[model samples]
Target: MKNEPRELLNNMFSAAVDAAQPSRCIAPFLPPPPRGRTIVIGAGKASASMASALEKIWPGELTGMVVTRYGYAVQCDRIEIVEAAHPVPDINGLRGTQTMLDLVSGLTQDDLVICLMSGGASSLLSLPLDPLTLEEKKNINRALLTSGAAISEINCVRRHLSAVKGGRLAAACHPAQLLTLLISDVPGDSAVDIASGPTVADPSTCADALNIIRRYGIAMPLAAMQILESGAGESIKPGNPSLASSDYRIITAPQIALEAAAEVAKAAGIPCHILSDRIEGEARDVGKVMAGIALQVARRNQPFKAPCILLSGGETTVSVKGDGRGGRNVEFLLSLAIALEGEDGVHAIACDTDGVDGRDEIAGAFISPNTLDRAWKSRMNPQASLDNNDGHTFFGGLGDSVICGPTLTNVNDFRAVLVLPKSADHQQEN
Candidate 1:
């Protein structure tokens, strides 16, 4: 019996995520044990796992703290694990940020600070600057998430607003040799963009943050706006002596994840075309463009023949016009399904490698030739759901939502579009 295409697609996704797991990738990049104390601290979906991975091979006694999104924590005995909100800031995250700051303060040159930074760290390390409350930071964060601003720009704002982000954490560890290992989830894998570069020097400024806020029309509190205007939130620049002893490396990224998926396709005798690992923009628009490419491959075989996978990885943005509960991956899948119009010989899957999409529990959703038809049969209006940004409920109605709780790793979004020949129509039903 031939393996099901959907199973293959799921396997490909698993491969992508597995390639970025902290345990597999973090070990090779681990720095040597310091001559003095080892203090580990981090914030992100994968930080907890990274800390746990560090504990296994680290030679000396390690004491540190890492904050991750709620429900994404892995058990660790020595290093404390704090679970908080993601894409949004909460009180727990605020308190955890202060504690993390304290953890690094007063360290001497003999101590070593290892920071495990990854995606979602900005929100997980939410400590507002003076005169800026956590509530204001949360409001700004929520606005930025729905503002269609690029991740880099959102992070720029985050760096300026926080007490622990944008190299501030690294600066706090001054005199202590700081090493940062990252699992990149941003499009370009800019170390400064990952977790707002908590352990790396930031080149962005308050003026840049103000410009982004203005460009996106994001409503900001007066005190926060004034802080940006007064230049009080200016981040530590590249030449800052406070960060002179810091070093960083991106242990894993979207490109690596996409390559892993491609290898899986190769093993299965399927031609895989990695369209791009840095595709960015509106999710629905990106979906439409991807749908067109898949159509061309199916109808003309121009780019490549059937029995191939068009894979792309990048973090897409969703300007929330409707009050719906769906992450960028599902939103893209919903839009792709609508654009495909139930075309035969095509199937697709979109999911975040971290196993959480937007603020929902589901990772993402699936798209098949019958996706639209099934929705119609179920009396679910796909367009209405899409309009309301309710792809979660839409796909849930058809039982197509891919739910795999926290995968404990993140390399950004993984998308696969499988186009088969007419001879393989039987596989579409399976």
Candidate 2:
């Protein structure tokens, strides 16, 4: 029996999310109970949820704290959950960061530090480098959000500017056994790039971070400039023995999520193809490229034949130059609809697994063959919307916004394209 379209789509998307959920991946990587105390620490959108999962599975005595985005907290008896700001630093986050740092300031080789790491850790654990006030960090963060820098570039700058990031936190707990459970959100899942790799070794140099800051034309506060110039806040270097005891495990990743979706497609009698899970850049540009790929598969059959789905995952950025609300996923959908204007038998959906895209309430947008046609009918100009970087508004106007509201676990973005066979009448005649 042919599966209902929406149900099939939901199943695929659900599989993608389930594949990356913390519960399924965290337990296997857990280390044997440390001889000494087990102190759990983490930061990210998924931090609290990860903590909860650990609590459910862990049978030993464990106590610690982890910072999570405000309203994203999960209750735990042993592990304290501190709600904080994300994508921008707030005083609460600063204080929480200090608390977390203090938690590991004195640990022995026998102690265990279970680090649950994921995306958004950078902002969630906001600690301004000394001499730089929290406000200064906020301004820099604001500028970076609007700077169109890639995740790696943004993270490079953040690692240099932060106090607990770039492996310094783990270094503080020298001699302790550090087992880092990671949910890979960045394109490459580089520990140094995810949440700025708070307790992980960093290969990024001070020079690389400075270059990104300058390239983005961010005006720094006097204190920030001084900290960098003095090199007073260097991260753990590659050979630092302080982090030698730390072990890393990827609990969930985009590739794993995409494969789950592919499996669903196969089970449903639908062909599946996954584009690069590492695609990045401006949201609109990436959307255009994806649209082109979809058109090829739909019209030419040069790649996989019809009855196929394209699954992809990655974090995309938007350089916000307008006031209208923007989200990377929504922008991608708009660009895609415009590119595929009126094309038959193609439908797509793009959403952030975290359920919040660029400060917007909606996760993403959906597109059908008539998406562009409907926009025109409603007197909406697709190009104008694109020009303003207002994808959230465009999709909202059509009531097509995918609102999932903080799935409580994040694995970056998910995109799917469904292609059906073209009519024989429309087939190109030789």
Candidate 3:
């Protein structure tokens, strides 16, 4: 309840993360145990944690496998946990996907298959459709990521190119009652976009993938391009027979996470406003827009007045043009700092709930009224750093980078802007 902006922001972020944790959100949505075998299969940053949670509460015996990002594995007595790469496909992921498909195959109508999915599954459940090698898929993934493509567009291509995604996994589990539990990180929480909808039907076609590639100027491999061009890469459409026995439930999403953070702000006796849970754009651009909103609240106390906190959750993209470290959260904060130009009464924090931003272990960063002054004292150039996409280094140099390691769960980006009353003295250092 104190007037500590940084601590308050951090607490809010933590509340959001805690609210989406598999242990807390997965239990209520779990399906009843099947009469025959219970097989669990999944892949994502949070899949292992979901498995662990399900194992603890599931009354029936179960066995299966799930793949999670490196350093995200949780021990489960019944379900085997495999660690794999994320945002890019690797050999481990390919093999894991094949194994999962094999495990789900040959199931009976009386059996049940539980599929746990989350944000990183698109990369972690990597099994390219034949003729498109793993290396080729990896290259396409790298290109799409650096091209600043939206998550949905990137996933459209992935679904078409994957052998086990886009209802293919559900196909493998046909005849069995399949239940998919998802922790959504995508805008709108579209099931088909989460982890490319491994256990759900995909309405997108190969032509959609081709359009995204053309729109983004993404270079595709010859085989991959041919597959899309010839419609050989089309995903399972809605109402597919294989998916008839399958059902999916999104247990947690960005909106839910944002509301949890808002509750924290309310508990602290501060009015909170959630801008949107599905905001999307280039990271720096989003930051500039947020800065405009914060400035309005600080200068004129318009909209919602001062001494209030603004919360939002969503994923933003970054087109890599610089040689420095990058993360959307830090990029957003860096741009916000530049736009604010040392405006008093404005303090903000931006972090990825997964505790990893871009390729760095740092979650995100913080910015206060003195952020620019401190960077100037450290001989850092805010504009130059931002131009180079070096937000992690920029904030790290100022000792303002938020480092929380891996939170083991991800909803998406968490942004909190705390605007104190204009009359209050802004002497506190964060």
The candidate maximizing lDDT is: 3
Worst 10 residues of 1 by lDDT: 421-430
TM for every model, in the order presented, reads 0.97, 0.96, 0.98
lDDT per residue (tens digit) for residues 85-190 in model 1: 8878898899898998899889999899998988889888889998998888888889999999989989999899888888888899999999899999998888
Summarize candidate 3's per-residue lDDT along 1-430 as a digit string, tens digits: 4658889998998899999999999888988888899999998989999999999999989999999999999989999999999878799999999999899888999999999999899999889988999999899999999999999999899999989888888989999999999999998899988998888888889988998999989999999988899998888888888888999899999999899999889988999999899889999999999999999998788898888998888899999899999899999999999999998889999999999999899999899999999999999999999999999999999889889988888899999999987544553432
Clashes per model (N, Cα, C within 3 A): 0, 0, 0
Clashing pairs in 3: none
Where in model 2 is the C-alpha error above 4 Å?
423-430
Cα lDDT listed for each candidate? 0.90, 0.85, 0.91
TM-score of 3: 0.98
Clashing pairs in 1: none
Pairs in clash, predicted candidate 2: none
lDDT, model 2, position 364: 81
